[model samples]
Target: MTMSLVFRNEKFSPDRFTGCIAERYQFINCDFSGCDLTDTQFIHCQFYDRESEQGCNFTRATLKDASFKHCDLSMNNFRSVNALGIEISECRAQGIDFRGASFMNMITTKSWFCSAFITKTNLSYANLSKVVLEKCELWDNRWVGTNVVGAIFSGSDLSGGEFSSFDWHSADFTHCDLTRSITSDLDLRSTDLEGVKLDSDQVSILVERLGIRVEE
Candidate 1:
């Protein structure tokens, strides 16, 4: 917690950081609404303030059913967080931005629904542009070069996710499970695998990258 260190609107006592271990703490404009923070363990935490490029706002925070294990939470901001049923497991979370995180729950205003469970998290280079996160559980996450251009993640399970240099046509994996993930930079002829649930060697490595040649 160096250089213009800040911690505003602080109010915590749900066991006062349940399992404590927070290094480099700096929470500017902190609200921490409905904070439970089960098993908390934040290391090298500096919610963002790269030379006044300010972040760490956590507006409208709820963090329902919170849990962040093996945490580093690199470059955290988590803007507009409601974070329904939040659970960030095995976390390193590189470059975490989570732009305007909500995870939805309207039930009116034209109805809405969403939740989060973020598993095996690494999320390298994370920005999560246009984050939505539909039908979520998000398994075995790594998602290198993560930036989900218009992120929806429809019907998400994201099985065993690694997704190297992932783009996958920029999000909205319709009915996604993506079995044993790492679809080799998935490009199913412009990427839109409706009801996606690929298996069988990731469907022969995504139809051999369109050079199709899968025997037996």
Candidate 2:
């Protein structure tokens, strides 16, 4: 039993929508500024151009199977969400906290996630292209089979992450921390590794990949 609701051009500021449950809702051009949506559940919802005028607070919200297209979600708190099968495209998600969130089967394209905290998040089988994750915390995250073409990860922490099936040929890893991160199967010939922080073992692996024999 799923109820359909629509909130078009509505504003929710300084309010509390905690513990609310809604299914198949549509939010078009709605503003959610300074609102506390903690523990609120929205299943199969679609948000189009949803604005966060003063930074909508979605801390601990459950947005399972939701889709956001061309929405402004900057400076929002999206930590601890059950975001499985989510689709976000052409959205502004800068400075959001997505740490420890579950994002399986997600697809995000042409979105901005700069300075966001996404450490320890599971993004397996996700496709993210032309996205900006610069200066974001991405340590200990699982990115197996993730498509990250044309993505920017400059000055981000990618330590202890598994990137076995990642397509990072056009992605930027400049000044990033790859300490203990797995790149055994990656072709670093065209990938940007300028000023990247790596341990001796990681450096050795990269040198070996380039067919450079080192004498010690």
Candidate 3:
């Protein structure tokens, strides 16, 4: 049994709502600052507001199967969040911390995630379209079979990640770091790698793919 609670235009500041389950709730113009929402479950919820610029903090929360459409969730602390199968469309989630979070099969469209921390996070099979992740920390993150069409990843650290199943031709990776990143199986003939930072061994691997002969 899940206890549902709906909040509309309400201010929930400095409140602790731990381990609560709310479903199908509509949050409009709600302010949740300095709030501890650890282990809370919010399913099928809609959080949208154009007039307000305030975002909520969900540090260590469990927001599995939630939907956020046109909401401002920027600068939120989402470290170790359980956001698997979450749907976020046209939302602002810039500078958010998603370290060690599991977002498998999540869907995101037209969202802004600039400078966000996504270290050691699992985004396997996630679908991302027209999303901006510029200058974000994406170290050791799993992106196997993830669709990232029209996504911007300029100036982001992509070191130590498995990117073999990604479509590089449709995504932008200007000036991104590929140090110790796996790309031997990726087809980079049509993909642009200008100004990208790569390790010496990784460069050799890419050069060999271009039919270049190297003598040691």
What TM-score does each of the candidates earn? 0.33, 0.51, 0.51
Off by over 4 Å in 2: 1-113
Over 16-114, each residue of candidate 1 has an lDDT whose tens digit, in order, gives: 565555655766535454455544555545554456544444445556656666655666667667777678887777877888788788899988988
The most accurate candidate by lDDT is 1
Clashes of each: 0, 0, 0
Better of 1 and 2 by lDDT: 1
Model 2: per-residue lDDT, tens digit, 1-216?
242777766776544454566556666655554345544554455453334444444544555444454444444455555554444434444444455444433247644334344555455655455556676667876677665666677888899887876676768889999898887566667777888898888777778889987666
lDDT of 2: 0.60
State model 3's lDDT.
0.60
What is each predicted model's overall lDDT from 0 to 1? 0.73, 0.60, 0.60
Model 1: how far is 167 from its true place, Å?
14
lDDT of 3 by residue, 61-167 (tens): 55555445444445444555556544454444444445545553324764433434555545555555555667766777666666678777888888887776678
